[model samples]
Target chain A: MEVHSSTAGAAAPPLSPGDFRELFDSVDAFLFDCDGVIWKGDKLIDGVSQTLDFLRSKGKKLVFVTNNSTKSRKEFAKKFGSLGISVSEDEIFSSSFAAAMYLKVNDFPLDKKVYVIGGEGIIDELQLAGYTGLGGPEDGKKTAEWKSNCLFEHDKSVGAVVVGLDPFINYYKLQYGTLCIRENPGCLFIATNQDAVGHMTDLQEWPGAGCMVAAICGSTQKEPIVVGKPSTFMMEFLLKKFQIDCPRMCMVGDRLDSDILFGQNAGCKTLLVLSGVTTLSALQDPANDIQPDYYTNKVSDFLDLLGA
Target chain B: MEVHSSTAGAAAPPLSPGDFRELFDSVDAFLFDCDGVIWKGDKLIDGVSQTLDFLRSKGKKLVFVTNNSTKSRKEFAKKFGSLGISVSEDEIFSSSFAAAMYLKVNDFPLDKKVYVIGGEGIIDELQLAGYTGLGGPEDGKKTAEWKSNCLFEHDKSVGAVVVGLDPFINYYKLQYGTLCIRENPGCLFIATNQDAVGHMTDLQEWPGAGCMVAAICGSTQKEPIVVGKPSTFMMEFLLKKFQIDCPRMCMVGDRLDSDILFGQNAGCKTLLVLSGVTTLSALQDPANDIQPDYYTNKVSDFLDLLGA
Candidate 1:
């Protein structure tokens, strides 16, 4: 295995096949950001399946970490199956799961319900964690009333307001969530992720969880406890759950802010790939503070390391 | 007419009946903020109708200026009629109308269309200004597909994305609006207002147009040109449209941030009424920068000056 050493403060150079093999050999566990590194939209990245197979053959622990809270871990695993990659639901750690785990770890009151301003994934996770959730897709439909004077029947049992990505996000959800946070004493404001945008395809990017989170935050004048990537909460959850050594774990991602920053905060080796939103020029920019330990063209480039 | 003097840079005390008469006599035109000062949640403030009548009897040019973009000028006029107040559509100026006027004044391309992420008010104003509008409530329904892979057929003719208060706001509208702004070359990004929350009633307040505007802004990283109160654009539009003398115009409102600031910025006398969102303590707070020229308990307080 080849080793190309560099100073800690400076940006690391792109990794060679042999250098990547050496790095891969050192790490026992791999945490991957799903969207850019493994797939873009519905299509899977070429050679990713073979790369994962090689990693598995080397007895490496593969964990899929994503900020997308629209789908539960089981659903994500189903998506993986459709993409021709075999993944267990337990091996996938989504932000929604992290949020649920957060509530569970905090010993949240079982009797109190959580008001959700998101999609099914957060609700599924909350339900799995033995917490009742209200105001998801079922409460997302537009009311027939002329004026927005629908008297929201306030439930005093609501102890938390959880926000994530909601395709069916409307004014009512925001209103109810705001009411929960503002009126309910000791009500927690939590966000699964604060991703500004999600790439649907190369040319198509849409507003993500951050938009909804920002909307709630803007109205309530309250900052939520974000539990997704870039926040140490998700990483801490993974560390506690899997008992993986941070030094021997590598975080492979395509985005600098969330993915690479999460790796840095998690005290893991980080690799940035050029296959997604980030560009080569962005990596070389002197203004950027967050730099990966190593970078390559794409996650599939690790296939060359296996050959080496 | 009565006169009372106060030290400069101090919070103005509530006006006496005689002092209010003096202020009223000085102004030939009176601009009102509808929600709090004139009415609150479908209920008209007592004595408001009589006070407006007295002002009209004195030959004051009354204009209903509101940041609410939900209803068009004609609709607003109808609402006024329902509230037992006679008003012409031309005398009502809303944020939606301001946005349309802004485009028209700037000589926006006639061939280009506008992509709306709002309600009917903005659409009506855009149409009235001879610009084709797309993607409002007509495109707000949730699509059948599970995945967010809606084929957003981009129209190159879309030159602006106008956002207002939309109860039917969904991911598709946000997605389509973002696409229009990012994909269309030099497409204008405009917001009617950035009001954080709107009061539906005493017990209910919901996220307003600002929440939706903030969502789009968070995703696009693009700052929109806001045309509502406190922006100066709306004031400028009103000033030019009516050819009103600034010194002879008095702005009456319940909120300090938008209404009072707007009046101050427009070089007009400002009257703050405690009938709305802000309280006496807030007005008296030294930390607050925006202050009105005159203060009253309510718009109806002016009635005492007229000996009603």
Candidate 2:
């Protein structure tokens, strides 16, 4: 199978047939960023199914690596299934899973609870990691009025405050998370992904996990330990779990800052696709320093480039 | 009248009786930060009334200035009356008032509406400034789930999005404000103040206007035009309206960053009071670059230092 492949940074050289085949021959695994690479919103990118089939048929390990913490890997896999794609939960490496893996890898205290300020997927991942989660959608309806006189109550046993992309984010969660971080001794502040905005739907860009994280950061006057893309936490987790050589894995996505940067930090080959939020002009703009090892109009170019 | 007065940054000289009288006598008007300088939570600082009376008796003008946009001038004046202090709406300069004044001073289009993600006070002030405000507590109860497919409707006539100290801040307002700033052409993003935390009550420090501002800032990926303290917009408005001389006016508050820096930026004398958020150690902390012209234990010290 021929593929888009080049080395180093910006304006990677055009790949000849031999270069393409040679790069694919060395790659043993492919890491896909779901949103723009596999699909945009609810619709799958054309020929992506065929590309996945070709990669799997060639015995390449495939994993969906997404910064969206809005859904757990189980739910994310279901989304793929609904899109007429075959995928398993184990092959999904969402930021929610990364957050859970982070806690697990760091040997978080099992007895202490986690205070969440995000979607239910984070709670699901936390539960799977053997920790009870508090303050997800349950706190969405709760609110604090201006000039609230009394101190609000919070669980004393909270060991961490994990923030992610929460559509139901409100002031209650902001204040609660701040309390957990500031008042609760040694309470950890963690973020799944700090994406400023996300195409939760293609109709528009909405506030993402970064807004929630920024609110908490403004209150507590501290930065969280981000466990999502570009942090290399997920890369290390993938390395330890999948036993794949970093140099042999190719990370494909549309975002330069999140996906390509994550791949670069992971020591994996990076591919940028233009089917999502980033435009071709933005990629070619001189101000943008982030460069992918390879780039194409879309991930489906893999199949088209092969003349399959 | 006796007072705390010195020159330059860092520690200024301790005040002598002659120095105190000379300083106070030179001041024709005093601008006070309400929450911390005038009162702590519900209770007014001891001798604040006597100090106000003493200032008024000496024919010195007094204006209450606060970064809090949670209440309009009318409501704020009522708060003063409740505390047994005689204050009028015209004698108050709140961030809400400043926000309204900013739009008016800038000659914003009268036909265009405003989208708000803040307290009712901002809405009230906007109405007073002849602009209709939408999406405040009205949108607080609105909910948006993860992956909401439809784009929420927004008024195309919205000319600006004003954010302030919103206790009812939610994702709906965040998204709405984001849409206005991003989609509405030339729509201004205005923030009343960006104080990181506030003593919403003396018992606890809750997230302040900065959190709400930060949330929108994250979503819109834009920095707002701050019209509150340390920005000089309010200072310019106060000067234009009240006809006060800059050098003769003393800005008194318990916080260094907001009140003191505001005074400095406005080219007026600044007084730091230890009765509120700041302490002596924090004042002495070399890491802090903000230095007031003078400092004292509390505003009440104005009367005590008189040796009455």
**Best-fitting candidate, measured by lDDT?**
2
**If you superpose only chain B onto the true chain B, what TM-score does each candidate give?**
0.92, 0.93
> Residue A41 of candidate 1: its Cα lDDT?
78
Candidate 1 Cα outliers beyond 4 Å, as residue runs: A1-12, A142-150, A200-203, A281-289, A306-308, B1-12, B142-150, B200-203, B281-288
Worst 10 residues of 1 chain A by lDDT: A1-10
Q: Give the CAPRI class of candidate 1.
A: acceptable
Per-residue lDDT of candidate 2, residues B248-304 (tens digit): 998998888788888877778888888887878888887777778778888878876
What is the TM-score, restricted to chain A, for candidate 1? 0.92
Model 2 lDDT vs. the true structure? 0.83
Off by over 4 Å in 2: A1-23, A146-149, B1-9, B12-19, B41-43, B146-149
Q: Choose the strongest candidate by TM-score.
A: 2
Clashes of 1: 0
Taking the tens digit of each residue's C-alpha lDDT, what string does model 2 give over A83-122?
A: 8889999888899988888889899999999999988899
DockQ of each: 0.40, 0.54
Cα TM-score per model: 0.90, 0.92
